[model samples]
Target: MEGMALNQLFGNAYFGRKVLVTGHTGFKGSWLCLWLTSLGAHVTGLALAPNTEPAHWSLLGLDEVHDLRVDLRDGQAMRQALQEVQPELVFHLAAQPLVRRSYRESLLTFDTNVLGLVHLLEAIRETPSVHAVVNATTDKVYAEQVIKNGYPEDHPLGGHDPYSTSKACAELVSDCYRKSFFFDGGPRTATARAGNVIGGGDWSEDRLVPDLVRAASTGSILQLRNPAAIRPWQHVLEPLSGYLRLGQALLAGEPVEGAWNFGPASDATLPVHALVSQIQAQWPGLRSEYLPGPHPHEAGVLQLNCAKAARELAWRPVWSAEDTIRHTIDWYRAYYASSRLLSSEDLQDYVAAAHNAGLEWAA
Candidate 1:
C-alpha cells in the first residue's frame, strides 16, 4: 500500500484546518512538514537553524512554508511564534536528537529536548485552534536495564544516556500536560515512541545508516559502534504514518490516548551487518569492513512492542527491510546521478507514498 492521494489525506472532512510543525527543518521534522503540505494543510514551521549543512529542512525547500527560525529553548520566542500560527495540529520534533552528541553536550540536549517540549505545550494552551498534538519521543524513552522481547508503553520510563533520558523526560512532560491541563481545557497531546528509522537524506553522524552510507561512498570501511547489538529497524515512513494517524484521531477527539510505539514488527529487527549488506547490495561500490569502535553509551538490544500502535493506531510498517534499504539507496543514487540535490517535491512525494502504503496495510 502506498500513501493516499493528497486530496484523500486532507479532504477527510476534518482536514488540517490549521497546522504548525516545530523543528520542521530536521530529518524527521522535514518529512512531516512535507507530508502536511502534500495533504493540503496550512503549515507553519518553527525551529532553530537546520542542524546539518545540507540540512534536511533546507533540502526539502521548507522556504515554501511560513518558516520561522527561532530557538525552542527561548520560551518567549517559542510562545510568540506559536501564538501567530494558532495551529490546530502541532507536531513537536525540535530537539537535540543524537545520543552521542548528548554525551558531548548533556546540558544542551536537556535544555533543547526537555525545555523545548515545555515551550510548545505552553504555546498550545494560548493558541485556540491547537486542539491536538503528537509529541515525538524515542524508543529509548523506556527504562531499559534489559531488552525484553519488546518493551511496552507501560515499561518504566528511564534512559541509559542523556539523549534517551531527556526524551523520557519529554514524555513525562507531555503526559503531565495531557492529563493535568488537557483534561479540562487544553490541547489533547499524545506521545509517540518510534524505533530506529533509516531512510533518505539522513546524514547525521553516529547513526549506523549515515555512517555506513558515508563510508561506503568513500570506499572506506564502516566502524560500527556495537555490531552485535540489535534494534527495531524500520523505514522512516512507518513511524511517521503512525504519528499522522495518531494526530488525526486525537484531533477528532477519538478514544485514542497516551503513548504508542510505531516500529517494524519483530521480523523487522535486523542487525548492523544485515542492514549494511542490504544497503550495499543496492548501491554497488559500497565496501564495509567492521573496525572496533566505542560510541557514546546507547542501548544494546532495544526493541519496542509496537503491538499497541498496531492495535490502537492500526499502524504497521509496510516496507520490508530490503525495501527500506532499496528506497534509501535509490535516493542517494538518484541524487548523484542527476548531479543535483534532491528537490523537496521528489522527497515529499516518495515518503508520502510510503506513508500511504503503510496506512493502507494497517487498514
Candidate 2:
C-alpha cells in the first residue's frame, strides 16, 4: 500500500493542462512543480529569487520549465503574468512565511501575506482560463484557544503574531472574493490550512527540522527556543497531496466553500523536545541544549481537526510522526553525504512509499 503510483490518483486530468504555481522557487512550491511536471502538466512558476542557497527549485532543476522571477506584491506584473500563462489551475503559495521574521518586518509581512494574496486573487479574477485555485495558508491562522483540542475550519480565525494574523486576513480575503465575485459560474477557489510542515529541501531560517539537520551535519550545539512548544506536525507531502485532491474536486465543478484543514492525526501533535530528540537519535553524538530566551509570542500548543477534509475530500495524512521524522532524517543525511543521490530520487521513493501505505488519495 505504501508504493502507490502518483498518476493513479490524479489520472490524466493534469496532462497537458496549463498550471501556474506561485512561489515555485520556495520549498513546497518546488516540490509541487516537480510533481506537476511528472504528471505531464504544463508548469509555470512565478516567484521572487530564492533566499537560501541550494534551494529545492535548484535541486530539482526547475529552471528547465517556465520559471519567472516576479514579486507577488506587484499586482500589475502578477496580472500580466497570469494573462501570459493562461493557466487552467493555479496554486497560490507565495508569502512572507516566518514568525520571527514577521516580527521584525511587520509591514513587509502584512503586505506580502495579506496583500500579496489579494493581488493573486485579483489576477485570478481577470484571467478567465483559470477555473480552479487553492490558496495555501497556515494552521496558525486560528486564534489561540485555552483547550488542547485540534482547531476545526470554522474556529474563530485570529492570530497572535503578524505572520499568522496576515494569513488569517488572507483567508478572509479569499472568502470575500468567493462570495463577492465567484459566487456562481466563476472559478472555484478554496484555502488550505496546514500545520508545521516538515520535509527535506527546507532550509528556511528558524524552522525546527532544518535547524536540526544543519546542527547534525556541522556538529554544532543546537540552541532551542521553546522546547515545550507543541504543534501538529506532518510531512510536507501530506498537505501537498491534500492540495492536489482539492484542486481535482474544484476542477470537476464541485462547490467547495471557504477553508479546509489538513493536519496530522490527533496524536501526532508532540512537543518540540520530543520531535528534536526523535531526529537527534538518528545522528550519533549530536549535542543539543535548550536555552530559554526572550522570544516573540508564539503558540505554545497548536493543532488542527481535519474532519472536514476527511469527510468531504476523503483526504488524510499518510505518514506517522515517527515515519515523517525518519524520512526527513534520511533525506538530509543523504543530502549532506552527497551520496550520488538527488532529492528528486528521494521524492520518487517517497511517492512509492505513500502508495504502499494504502493512502487512497495517493492511489
Candidate 3:
C-alpha cells in the first residue's frame, strides 16, 4: 500500500528545519538538496568540488544554497564544518561509489567510504543540534549469496570487493555508534541500503546508464563487464523517499532507527543486457557488445527485500523498470541534444508523476 501525503507525513517537519547534506555535489546528494530546498528546509551542503566538469551540482544550480567544499577524510575540517552548520538533520551520502574504480584505488576507497564515516560520526557525536541521521549505503554491503529472493534487513553483512567491504564496515561503525552513544541522548542514526539506482543527472563514469548513453552518442560499441549479472534497479527517487520517510519518523520520535533496505519491487531486478536493450529501444540506436575482459569481482545476482520499508515506512517504488529506463534515456537525450539540464520544473514534474502514481511522498 502507498503511504500518506508528504504534507501529512512531514507536518512541517522540514519547513525551516536546519538540514546538512554531505556529498551535496554528487548525483543523489544534489537531488536530495534540491528536494529539501523545495520543502523550505535550510539546506547546508559540505562536499569536495564536483569531480566532473559537467556535474549535476552546477547544472542544478546548487550554489543557491549553503554550499561548502571540504574533504570528509579530514576529520578536523569536517568536524569544524559540521559545528558551523549545527544541523538538526544530517544525510550522509559521501563515498567512493564505484566497484571497478575501487579495485584500482583500494586505499582511497577504504579511506573515503569507511574512515570518512568515522569522521562524520565523530562530528555528529559532538554536534548538539543534530536530531537524526540517515547514512546512505549500498545493497552491495551484503555477502554475495547466490539466491533469487531478496536479502532482508537482518541479512549478514559481508563484501568481497573493497567498495562493498568498506560499506559493510561503515554499517558496523554506525551500529556501534547507535548502540554505544545515540541510544541514550545522541542523535538517532540509521543506515539505508538501496539497490542500483538509475536516473537523470547521474554522469558518473563506470555506471551502466551513463556509459551506455555516452557510447551510443559516439556510435561506439557498449562494452559491458558483466552483461548477464542481475541487479535490483529503481529510479533514484525510490530509495530517496525511503530515506526522507525514515528521517521524518526519527524526528517524530518513532522507533524507526537502525538498518533498513529501500529497494524496488522484485520485478525490477533485471540483467545488465536487458537494461541496455530497454534503453536502446527508447533511444533507437544504442549498439552494445559484451566484451569478455579481465574485471574485478562483482555479485552476479543481487536483490533486496524491501518488506521492512513497505511495512514500516509505507514506502514502495513508484516506477517500473521500463519506466525508469525511459525516464533516464529521455533525460540524457534531451540534455545531449540541447544541453537543457534538469531544473525545478523537472523536479516538480517528477513529483507530480509520483503523485499521479499514488506515491505517498509525492502527495
Candidate 4:
C-alpha cells in the first residue's frame, strides 16, 4: 500500500484482521489469495473446488488456503461461513463465471451469479465488521454495450448471454443493496467490472488464453469460434492489484462507491488473432493452429475506458500486450521446464518477479 494514499491502506495488512474471499479456489481466486498472503492479510476462502482438470488452484497448492469448499447457492452455508469469518474486507468472486458452460446450465448460471451475490449481500447486511464489500462483476454487465470505442462508467448495464445477463443481474442486485441497505448506515460497497481476464495458471474451458495454453501443453491445435472477437485484454495481476487498491480505499472510509472498470489502457485492447499471435511468438516450440469451432455468443468488439479508475484512484495498467504475453507464456514454459522442477515458492517468486519486472498495471 506504499503508493496508496494514507486515506486508503488503513488496513493494508491482514496481520490480525479477517479477509474473506469467495471463489478462492478458482484461477483468479488463487491469484487473489497469493496477493493477499503477500500483503500479510488473514484470508479465508469460500467457494466450490476447481472443476477444471489439471486444477489451477491445487496446482498452486492453495488446498491449505484456510478455505472452505461450498457452493455459493447454499444460502445457509454461505451465511454460516460469513458469520464464522466475520471478515472486515470481503471479495466476492464466487459464482458460475463461464459463458459457454452457462449456455448448458442457464438455471445454475442465474441461480449462482445473481442469487448467489444476493446471499452474500444479505449476509453482509446481517454480519458486523464488514467495512468494505468489493463485489466482482464482469464488463458484460452493460446491456449490449460495447459503446463503439470505449465503455465508460456510465454505460448501460447489459448482457447478451445467460452468463452475461446473470452478471448484469448481479450488478443490479449490487446496486439495489448499495442504495437500499449499504447506504447511510450500511457498509461501504462498490462493484468491479473487469475484462476477459488472462493469467499463468488458468486452464478453464471456453476462454481463449487458457485454451491456447492447454492445447500447447498437450501438443494440439487451438480452436477459435470467434477468431475476430476483440477484448480489453489485461493480465490477471493488473485488476487484482486494482481490487486491492480499491479495497484499501473503501476500508479507509473514502467516499468511493458504485461501479469501476479495471482494464488495460486504450492501447492494450487487442483482437483475438493479434493476442494469439503474440502468445505464439512467445512460445515458438508449442504446436498450435487455429481451427474454427462452435462457441457461445460473445461480443464481437469489446473495449473499456478506465478513466474513472485513473482519475479518481490514480491506478493504471503498466504492461503492454507484448510484455504481458511474454511474461504469461514464460510462467507456463518455465514452470514445466524439463531441466528443473518448479516449487510453490518458485511460482510465488515468478509472480512477484512479473509484477516487479515492469509497471504492469502499476500507475
TM-score-better candidate, 1 vs 3: 3
Question: After superposition, which runs of candidate 3 have C-alpha atoms over 4 Å from their true positions?
Answer: 1-9, 343-346
Whole-model Cα lDDT per candidate? 0.77, 0.84, 0.85, 0.76
* Candidate 3 Cα deviation (angstroms), residue 228: 0.4
* TM-score of each model, paired residue for residue: 0.91, 0.95, 0.95, 0.89
TM-score of 4: 0.89
Candidate 1 Cα errors over 4 Å, as ranges: 1-4, 10-16, 145-148, 340-363
Deviation from native of the Cα of residue 243 in model 3, angstroms: 0.9
lDDT of 1 at 219: 79
Best by lDDT: 3
Clashes in predicted model 4: 7
lDDT string, candidate 2, 1-363, tens digits: 122344455645777789999999998998889878777789999999899987877777765579888898999999999999999999999889999999999999999998898888899899999898899999999989855568888899998899999999999999999889988777889999998988888999999888887888888988999999999988888888889888888898776757999898665799999888888787776778988878788999898888889888878887788778877788888878873334566567667766677665556
Q: Tens digit of lDDT per residue, candidate 3, span 1-363?
A: 122233343445787899999999998898888778777789999999889768878888755589999898999998999889999999999999999899999999999998999999999999999999999999999987875568998889999999999999999999999999898888999999999988888879899988887888898888888999999988887788788888888998988989999998667899998888788889887788877867888999999988888888777877778767777777888888999875454556556666787765555
Residue 185, candidate 2: how far off, in angstroms?
A: 1.7
